[model samples]
Target: MRAATKENNVRTCLACGAKSDKGALLRFAAAGTIIVPDWRGTLGGRAVYSCLTTDCVARFYTLKRFPEKFFKGTPAFAISQGEIHGWIKTQAEASLAHFLGLARKSGVLTLGQNTLADILENGGTAPTAVLLAADLADRTLREITGIVPVGTPVLRWGTKETIGASIGMRPVGVVALGRSPITDRIVHYCAIVNHFSQEH
Candidate 1:
């Protein structure tokens, strides 16, 4: 499959009809009677896209576009907005977990604080981004942030235990996602999760 980041690829949001880079939009695939978030963009079926903003997500359901646009020819069914919100949250979390696991297996992710700090300090081949545990200590967080290269994205995601488990390690305070094919997807899903968190 082609990478979603191909420059020529663009998607139109079903909710607002805004055109955006395919990578900037969230994908949803028809699943029987319900529509589900397809953050990986791998699900096979009719797909709809939406921008990353919370307004776009809210508009998607507020405008009631899913059934008409994605489930044509089937009788319309009602689903609570709260239910859809929950599904999107679940999908975002699962997508994040999956991507982190893949990065670990592909050997593109570095776990532990010192290893990441060394990579940043050495400046040989720095990671594209840093993932810190949400509960990281203030002193440690400050130290890591001080060493991270400017313009590199730093994300506070998941608990220490959650991040550690994704990489088959014990609880870790931070991880560095190196330059790799999956890095873009990792960044995208992290944004989605952040958006969801801010919304609800």
Candidate 2:
């Protein structure tokens, strides 16, 4: 995949009014009479952008900003804030899942506790982040956490079986995400997931 050029890559968030790389913001597109989250940013319609952070997302909803920004002079659709929030949460989770699958296919994912631990210990190039199974054993979690270098984020996500299936392997407790386009996307979506979880 060729790198994205700079000209069409910057977008201003409708909520925050701050400029950021397009990929760093969530894109929403009109779907029929209602606005919906556009996770892949490929929807064929006018798109509104917002920062993925909870503050921006919350401001977008709490201040009732979407109607003015999305509808303009057109008659407003009867869209509920709850529905939009649900869509945002669903899309965030789906984005994370989709990138994990891609990372696996591209050979940028390391599976199993020992494999991830080896990467951490041998440390020439380190993974962008580590993923621990939500139900991972306390002993294994501590062992892996101890080995991971400072400043690298560790995310607890999914069960061992679910994560393993995503990577086409048998159930495994730990995985490491290496540097790649997919890794960047995974990190972004993970932040959205974490933010929403904390707020609710």
Candidate 3:
């Protein structure tokens, strides 16, 4: 949940034993005797990593010791895999919404189909990514998908109302984000949410 990148940001997954970028994994840190999530990496403690997949998340907790004994003592832990997963889902959802709002306030957002289509066609600031409402009409989805340039991420999440409300507007189905640090973070959260949704 940390900012998608930190220097020396590499961490090993406690369950899978595979090395990956720290931002790609869920992060946990011990708070005194209670373990807490470093959802933003600002929790300021020694941290552990776990893959986002349910199997890995569950496996991480069932290990012989918490985070394989990274801590000095086995603090009595009561958290379950399902609870952790719920926290992750909620955090990721909120993070995405937070970034989207930031994008709008920062003037990096293009809203609705007509505006987005015009920008794409007329060569306005090319979007780095696109977000389509989960309930976007099929015809609009197809049209937008075909128009978006290759390699640009097209994330499908939230409904028209949810997406529009995030930007403080009426119901809108499409949102285009220009290049920005916030956009990159949005992409990262989208991956977590999308991957978790698929697995569940």
Best by lDDT: 3
RMSD, one per candidate, in order: 3.4, 3.1, 3.5
Q: What tens-digit string does per-residue lDDT give for candidate 1 at 1-200?
A: 96666556788997889998876787878878766677678899788888877778778866534556567653332445666566666777887888898998999888888988776667768779999999999999998888888898999889999988877789998898889878778888887788777744
| lDDT over C-alpha atoms for residue 34 of model 3 | 68
Model 2 regions more than 4 Å off: 1-4, 62-70, 74-79, 119-124
Candidate 3 on 37-85: residue-level lDDT in tens?
Answer: 6778787768888887778887877776664455655544446656777
Q: For every model shown, what is its TM-score relative to the native structure? A: 0.81, 0.83, 0.84
**Which pairs in model 1 have colliding backbones?**
none
**Stretches of candidate 3 exceeding 4 Å from the true structure:** 1-7, 67-69, 72-78
**Looking at model 2, which ten-residue stretch has the lowest summed lDDT?**
70-79
Rank by lDDT (best first): 3, 1, 2
Q: How much lDDT does candidate 2 score?
A: 0.77
**lDDT of each model, Cα atoms only?**
0.79, 0.77, 0.82
Write the candidate numbers in order of decreasing TM-score: 3, 2, 1
- Clashes (backbone N, CA, C under 3 Å), per candidate, total 0, 0, 0
- Write the residue-wise lDDT of candidate 2 on 71-148 in tens digits: 554433334655655667777887787888899999988887787766667765777888888899999998988888
- Between which residue pairs do clashes occur in model 2? none
Q: Please tell me which predicted candidate would have the highest TM-score against the true structure.
A: 3
